[model samples]
Target: MSDRLVIENLQVSYGSGAQRVEAVAPMSLAVPAGQKLGIVGESGSGKSTLLKAVLGLIRPPGVVRADGIWLDGTDLRSLSRREFRARCGSEIAMIFQDPVNALNPAFSIRDQFRRSFRLHQPDLPRSRYTETMLRALASVSIDARDKLGRYPFEFSQGQLQRIMIALACSSPRLKVLLADEPTSSLDVTTQAQVLDLLHALQAELGFSLIIVTHNLPVVAELCDRALVMCRGEVVEDTDVISLFEQPTHDYTRHLLASMASLPRIASGAAS
Candidate 1:
């Protein structure tokens, strides 16, 4: 099957010369048009670095190299920053773990929603933009009227996360969502609710997702395949069920064991 996103022999390093820290080493993976692939690892495992390299959001002083990162056969690394932004901003959207930090504190929910709308359809009339924003909020079960004028700080964490989801959904060309621990800061119940919302939206929108999280159970419940990262390399990649039933890598098994040893608190409890 053809991939919507492919990373080949990717390497990322932070710092210069002897002081440098290698974050990724010869990593490769692919996400087909509408598949959910989870990258699981503890902190410092390079999972987030991999995602940033794909997004071309790596800042100066950090070095990134890859044989190629192809998006539907186009080499993304070959494009100039402006060219890539023109294509990527609409075709790909990301949701961070903390929606509060991702959103603007001064802007109303309506203002943030407009940012997405402008990216996809800047020429849309005032009434049409408002209509699209309301529909996007409604799709996530948010009360469009009550929350539209409120700023990010005025809403609960779960509500803010859903609004971010709505912002992602507002863009018609969004074909992939790069989610980095989207529910890490939420309460257990809220986490499950947000995850379910993400699953529903992915299925409904026909968009692929690459979720980076250390939570094994969440990966089991949400993703079809898993990529296990240790240090700076991908040690294991397999279907989610197969991996849980019979893991190949020692590191993968260790991760599962760690998750198993956690308190048997129910989902949605503060972790």
Candidate 2:
């Protein structure tokens, strides 16, 4: 299959001159259609910055410069901000790390879904919208009728994450899912459940995935290929099995060693 997303010489920097800092050095990557790729890095390794740049979310004083960012043959950099926002969730959706903070505390679940639908499917009738929302929730094993009236604070973290997943996948135009540290805040069993849900949804929907995380086990479980980044640059790129079995970069080896020292916990195990 053709590449679903392609990024070339992507760079991000904050501030000017004396105060400037490079958050992400020049880098290039490609994600083929329906493939899952993991980006593993420590906290300051520019993983989040890279994701933000790709999403066109970088604010003033934080500059994003790239030779090209193409999504299925369309050049993203050429699109206006309004054009980008229109395409964002439908063409490329993002699932943030903190579901609670990502959601509006004052809005009910149905309200949130309505806002999303407005952006992507403004002409959709009310009945159709409700039906679509309910079906999306059901895909993640959530009961829309019972949960739609509740605020973000009412649900457990795991449920909120599942809801976010549902929202991301609801659009028929969705081609790529960008997940940034998506399972970091959840408990062990909930983390496993979310991962399983992501895998199942990807299988059923056929969207490409780019998961940004520091967790090696998460990558191993869900990704076929992995990229290891350190100090604002990609140090290694290899298939998931080879990354763990014979990491070439020193930093990759260190990361593997760190993971090795942690206690082994099976997926879905009680915390």
Candidate 3:
């Protein structure tokens, strides 16, 4: 498969001069179409920072620099702020750790979904937006099509996350989906279901998947390749099996040894 997203010399920082902190060191990676790549790191390891920097989500007082960030042959860095924001969700989408904070509580589900439709298809008929949203909801097995009038607070955490996934993946133009700690906030059973939704959706939609999390089992279950990070640096880059069987980095080995719930990695299935 061809590369859907490519990054070169990406770096991020906050503050200035002596106080300037390097949130993410320069790193490069390419995600091929339909590939699932997991980035594993502890909290503050800069994995999430890397994902945000690629999406240009870092705010003022924070700095994001990259040699290039190309999505589907288009260098995202070349786009204006408006254009870049437009490219997100339409071509590349991100799912956050918590849907509660990620989604606005002020808007009804219908309004939020309508805005998503508008983002992905600027000229999509207003009349079709509702049906389109219903279809997206159904894709995730949510029976909330008619309940679009409900607010984000009305749904369970798992239901809201499924809706979040549907919102992120609804666009046909989408080529890459970046999930940051997507399952960390959910119960074990819900986490499994959400991960399965992500895997199945990626397969059905043919989008490259990049997940950043501390969950080793999630990586083993959903990813083909894994990147182990610590102190804003990649300590190990290998296939999932190698990552589990022959960890090259001391940190990686320690992480593996500490896990109490190791899934059957060879089966290559999410629990």
Best candidate, lDDT: 2
**Can you write out model 2's per-residue Cα lDDT over 1-271, one digit (the tens) per residue?**
8999999999999999999989999999999999999999888999999998998889989999999999998889999877777888888999999999999899999999999999876666877988999999999999878778889999999999999999999998899999998888898778888888898888889999999977787788889999999989999989999999999999999999998887543353211
TM-scores for the candidates? 0.93, 0.95, 0.94
- Model 2 scores a C-alpha lDDT of 0.90
lDDT of 3: 0.87
By lDDT, highest first, what's the ranking?
A: 2, 3, 1
What number of backbone clashes does candidate 3 have, counting pairs of residues 3 or more apart or in separate chains? Answer: 0
lDDT of all predictions: 0.84, 0.90, 0.87
How many clashes does the backbone of model 1 have? Answer: 3
Which of the two candidates, 1 or 3, achieves a greater TM-score against the reference?
A: 3
The clash count of every prediction, one per candidate, is 3, 0, 0
User: What TM value does model 1 have?
Assistant: 0.93
Question: Candidate 3, 86: how far from true, in Å?
Answer: 2.3
Question: Can you tell me which runs of candidate 2 are displaced by over 4 Å?
Answer: 265-271
